[model samples]
Every structure is written in C-alpha cells, then in structure tokens.
Target: MKRTEAEQFTRRLTHHGEGPVWLGHHGLAVLDMLAGDVVLIDDSGAETRREHLGAVVAALRPRRDGGFVAGLERGFCLLNDRFTVTETVTCWTSPDVRMNEGACDPQGRFWCGSMAYDLTPGAGALWHLDPTGAAVQAIAGIGCSNGLAWTRDGTRGYYVDSLTGRVDILELRPDGAIANRRPFVDVTGEGFPDGIAVDQADGVWLAMFGSGLLLHFDRTGRRDAEIAVPVRQVTACTFAGPDYSELYITTSRYGLTDPEAAAGAVFRARPDVGGFAPYAFSG
Candidate 1:
C-alpha cells in the first residue's frame, strides 16, 4: 500500500513517448512512437535531441558495439555510432502491423512485439532478433504486444500483451529461448499495462496506462506499492539516474482531448530498490 508521486522531468516533448531506456554513458533515450523520432534528453534536463528515423519508431536500445538497435515500423534496424541507421531488416510485409515495445535480453538478443495499427485482435505477434541479424516469431496471435523485460540473472522475463489484461512470466532457457509461460499478474480491472522494468531484486515496476499509476510487484508477484505519475497516459518506464535508483516514466498525448501541458512529458521518481542498466544489443 506504499505510495509516491512522480515529478516532471521534461516538458511535453513527445506526442506518444513509448519506450524509455537508460544507456549508461549515453544518457536517456525515449521514443516518440508514432512520430518516428528518437529523442535524447540530457541528465540536466536542459537539452534534448530529436532524430527522425522513419514513419514510426517504436523502441530503442544501445548496442554493445557502440551504436543502437531499434524497432522500426515494420521490422528492425541497426544504427551506427552517430545514431544513423546503417542497415534495415523487414520481418513482415504487413502494412497494417508495426513494431511496438521491446528490450534486450541478457544474452544481447533484442525482442520486440508488434500490434496492428488498427488494433485488430490477434493480428500482432512477438519477435526476437538474435545477434546474428536473424529473426523469429516468439509468440503469435498477440493482441497488443507491448512491454518486455528480463530479470538481472536472465532466468526470468516479464511480457505484456495489453489486450490480455495481464503480465505473463517467462522462464528463460540457457540459450535465451523461452522454456515456459504463465500468468504472473492479472490487471483486468485496472488500466492496461503498457511497459515495465525489473529491478535488481527481481521486482516488477509496471506502468498502468490510463491509470496514472506505476505499480510495484515484489518478486512473488504481489502488489507492494503504487507510484503515481501526473499524466494519465503513462506509457513506459525504466530505472535510470546515477545509481539506477530513479524510475523514469514516459507519457502519451495520443488520445487525450486537449491534454494538459504535462501529458506527453517524461517523469521520474526514486523507488526503494535499484535496477540494472538495459542490456545492449550485441548485433
């Protein structure tokens, strides 16, 4: 039953800020999802950089080789040192579906999920892109594929298919493949779970879109606390800041009617535990 409030960290910088990641030495990066923009915000919150990638850019993460791997509209792409895309791989030819949210596993493979732009049921799926540039469909018939994260030990994973109204737990095999899947938490009556972050303690911090709350579930999946963000369309979150003690949240102005000034802004709050830096894409 613990509760806390998040403070605004930036102005209304994105129309639909979806994925937020902390790139250790590179600062914070969040995607303006439907706008195809990759935004970089300095630590001081005094500077911001926007780079347009395509018609839509869903998610992004740093690369181990000094660049980045991003989920573009239909597939994925590799960015160079300057953050310019050097290669693109299209996994599907469907103009109706697009990549959504994702994260890198401990083994350095990037996993992103997709959803039909029209929100058609069972038209989306989860995809995994290994370090060798090959891709595979990990889960099919996904309604709204979103939020993916792994535990510090890489033994477990948390995945969200918004349409299911639940977060599913995953058992990761030694080769990084999924061994099993089951329900971890059912959020049917609450708002949709958009994004999540797993702390070093294996706790899951989830952003409940439209609920304006970031829920904290302990290792056993019991709800322990809720962090309130000022904006209602809270989309995603990640642990950042110096010691990874700060939780950074992204909000969306996508469907709001005359949304408030902070609707599309990013927010931050310090939680009780710390989180590990996002895994870098090895490919």
Candidate 2:
C-alpha cells in the first residue's frame, strides 16, 4: 500500500505541547510542559486554555467521573470539567523526582512513571493509582520512564524507559499487579522511545522522540512499519477521530534553536492499522 502524506494538524504553541491523549468525542487533551498548563483542543484546532498546573504537565488520562488526571513533573493532579485541580497526588518522598508519561488500564487504574528531570539513571519509578485516589509504587530502579500502554487482552503491559533506549513488557496479574519483566524492544542510535499506543491487533505504535519518526510493532516485538514526520521531536501520539483511524502526534521544540520553533507542531496521518478501543475510567 502507498504511504500517505503526513498532514500538519495544529500550529505551534508558545510553550511546547508534549503529551496528547484522545478524550472520546470531546477533543484532544494536551500538556503545555514549559508553561505548566493543560489545554483542550477541539476538532477545529482551537485551543481552550484550561488551567495552570504547576511543573511540566507530561501526560493526561480521562477519569471516570467526567474529569481527567494529568501527570506533572512533581506529581499528578485531578481536573474536572472546569479544569481545576480538585485533587493532587505527590509521587516522590524526595524533592528530586518528576513524573513523565502515563495511561490508564482497562480496570481504571492510572499508571504513571517518574524520573529525574536531568535524565539521571536509576532515578525513576512507576506507580499505580486505584479508583479511590490511593497511589502505590509498582516498579522502581529505572531511568526516564515514558510512554505506557497495555495489550488489548489486558494481560500484558508495555512501557518505554527513554534514557535506557528500551521498551519493556510486563505480565499483569488479575489484581492490577505486574511481573515477568523483560525487554520488548530496544531502539538503538539516535532517538529515544517517548510515547506508545496499542492497536486493536495488539501492534504497538511508538513515537521516536528527536528522530521524527513513528514506529509500529507487532505483539511479538517485531517492527512492522515506520512513518516519518517533519517535526524532529515527536513526543507522543494517540488514535482519534470517529473510527479511531486518525493518528494524532504531538511534538516539541524544547532543545531546538529559533529556526526549529515551527518544529514544535502536531501532525496526523491515517495508517493501515486500526486502533483498539481506548481504556476508559470506570470509577
């Protein structure tokens, strides 16, 4: 099949918009990392400034009660329709930790990982938040945790450890616990794995940050396809649109020069693969 042209979906924002997730028919939720804000963008590409969330807002996942949970550098916050921080969960006992990427499981548990802002090794950990807002550390001893997704069957979880250049898959038990950790994919050379999404066929879509590319992988950890993007820092992606065929990607210009400002834009394309039904909060 002929590859489709990548379409520019959204213009550049003053601060970089990193993490993006689909919120059903509502719109796309984006995190303005540098300005510490959360903005909701509708299908018309108009950004509705929601609230000022301190630190960098890295990722967002919809909640059960019509609100959403946003992952910030220091911790996480809960936002309602009015976009206020109604609840907050601090991830670190020390002051050096910062949260990165996050997603929800089929059972409505919010899973997020944290790392040192400076990319220090062994300075990150993953945590799981139950429906009741109680948080627990699920895994530790990691570097730069980002991009998390689960298999369609809900028996496995996939995640990216960006600094280590590896994606790991874990066996998830019935009680929302994970085990049998192993490397699922290793990205070599330039780019680091940033965000991930699992399709209906159990294929994993990975955004290679700083490389301007999106990668597709089958369940057995084999590269199925790759799509290139104009933006160098492809931060994250999610399946949107009515049929979930539209793949919307978020990019950043955090370390780029002035000439690269336009590089911090969102892009979209429709691949041959279809996405799975996004996990919803059931609390």
Candidate 3:
C-alpha cells in the first residue's frame, strides 16, 4: 500500500485532547485530558483555557446560545455564558464510570459515554442528557466509547467503542432512544480508532491514534481515503477555516516516548473533501 500524505497546520500545546468540535460562527472547542479543562480556541488561534475542571476531560460541545458543555472523567458540567461552571452531574454514584466521548443529537440531546480509567473493558456505559438537565444511562457495558457522529438527516447515530475496534450504527428514534444496533465498521492492524467526524456527503473521518493516519469511510464503512500525520497519538479532528475546507486535527504526547513527543502537535490539511456544518445545542 502507498503511504498517505498530509500537511501540518499549527503546532500548539494540548496534552491528550480527546474531542474537538467546531463552534458555529465562533471558533473551536477542545477537551484537555491532562489539565481536565475545556479550552476555547478562537479563529485567530488564541486559546482561553478553563482549568482544574475535574479528573480528566473527555469531550466538549458548544451550547446553542453561547457558552459550552463538557464531559469529564467524573461527570458532566455546563458552562454558562461567561464560560463558568453553572451545573455539574456527577458519575460517582451508580455504574462508577468516567465520561469519554460525546456529541449533541440533531434534536438537541447531549449524549456522552462513560468508561473505567484503567482501560478496562465492559466497565462503562453511554448516557444522554435532555434539554432540561435530566440524565439517563442509555446503554451499559460499553468498553470505551470514543467517537460519535450522526447522519445528515439525523435519523442514524454512529458510535465507536475503541476496545472493540468496532463502530456501531443505530436508528435514532423519536424519543432519543437508539435502535437497530449493528456493526458499521471494523478496523484491524496498527491503530485503534479514537475520534470521528461526518461530512456533508455523509463520509466519516476517523482518527487512528497509533497508526498516525486518518481514514475516511463512506456511509457504508468502505475505505474512501487516508491522510497521514507525524503524531502517533492523534486524538480527534474537525473541519475548520473559512469555507470549512480545512481539517483541523488535535494530537497528544501522552504515553509517548521521546521520539514520539516531537511529533505530538495539532495539524491541518485540505483533503479536497467537504464537511458538514457542526451541530449546535440550540436548547
């Protein structure tokens, strides 16, 4: 197989950034796992970091009216207009899990996953939070829920469990419950799947952590394209820039040796692919 080519965009400090989502009409939001913070990086590349959040941050998404919402290792929190913590939902009670990856459904529901900190399989669950702040565990015994995306029409939901090396698709019901759980894709060899994003054409871009490659799959999970990066621990990616043509990738140096540390940096590249508009939490 031929090597995939990729171009670097920008190099910044983000230790173990797991989830990156674009804030419509604004900038980008990232979850810093080491600092346990939700950081907002504007269009100019200036970042405002909210620190000392919790154990570890797993995912972040923007609220419709401004502010943001983040999921941490311990629970979930709401960021107010001023980016302050307005409310927090802890996960220390039942199930004893940590938040992993999450995204807002088309209907404005926040869905996030929880897993054990030790990378133990079958020790986590998927949860959903409604507009009114009510939280419920939707699925249990999830190994490591990592990537999340939705179809264009908002009728299908795709989720990845890293440990299983499988991506599952579900039919989105009217009541926010998922049905028809089936394997959409299976990745073998080299890297494990970490984060994902869906394009306007319904293509899925998956970040392969250990392989240092981003694999693009069609709606049916067939390999469409691949892009290479210098970093071995690329955690997540999203479309940014003026026309939403540039793909911004976030990487990490966590668990890396000296050689790998040098390559742990955020990158950008134009894949000649069109991405979908990011979903905002209007509720």
Candidate with top TM-score is 1
Candidate 1 global TM-score: 0.98
TM-score of each: 0.98, 0.93, 0.91
- Candidate 2, residues 202-253, lDDT tens digits: the string is 8888899888888888889888787788878888888877778888888887
Q: Which stretches of candidate 3 lie over 4 Å from their true place?
A: 1-4, 44-52, 94-96, 259-263
Candidate 1 ranges with C-alpha deviation above 4 Å: none
| Model 1 Cα RMSD, 1 decimal | 1.0
Model 2 clash pairs are: none
TM-score of 2: 0.93
Estimate, for each residue in 1-283, the C-alpha lDDT of model 3 and write its tens digit: 2346666544555777667777765567666776786666776566755455777777777787787777766677887766678888876665456788888888888888887878788998888778788787888888988888887778777788898887778777788877678988889665788888877777788999888888888887888788888877787888876577878788887776664643545677677667766665654
Per-prediction backbone clash count: 0, 0, 1
| Top of the candidates by lDDT | 1
Model 2 ranges off by over 4 Å: 1-5, 258-261
Report the lDDT tens digits of candidate 1 across residue range 58-164.
88988997999999999999998688999998999989999999999989999999999999999999998889999889889999999899999888899999999
RMSD of each: 1.0, 1.9, 2.3
Order by TM-score, highest first:
1, 2, 3
> Which stretch of 10 consecutive residues in model 1 shows the poorest summed lDDT?
40-49
Which 10 consecutive positions of candidate 3 have the poorest summed lDDT?
Answer: 1-10
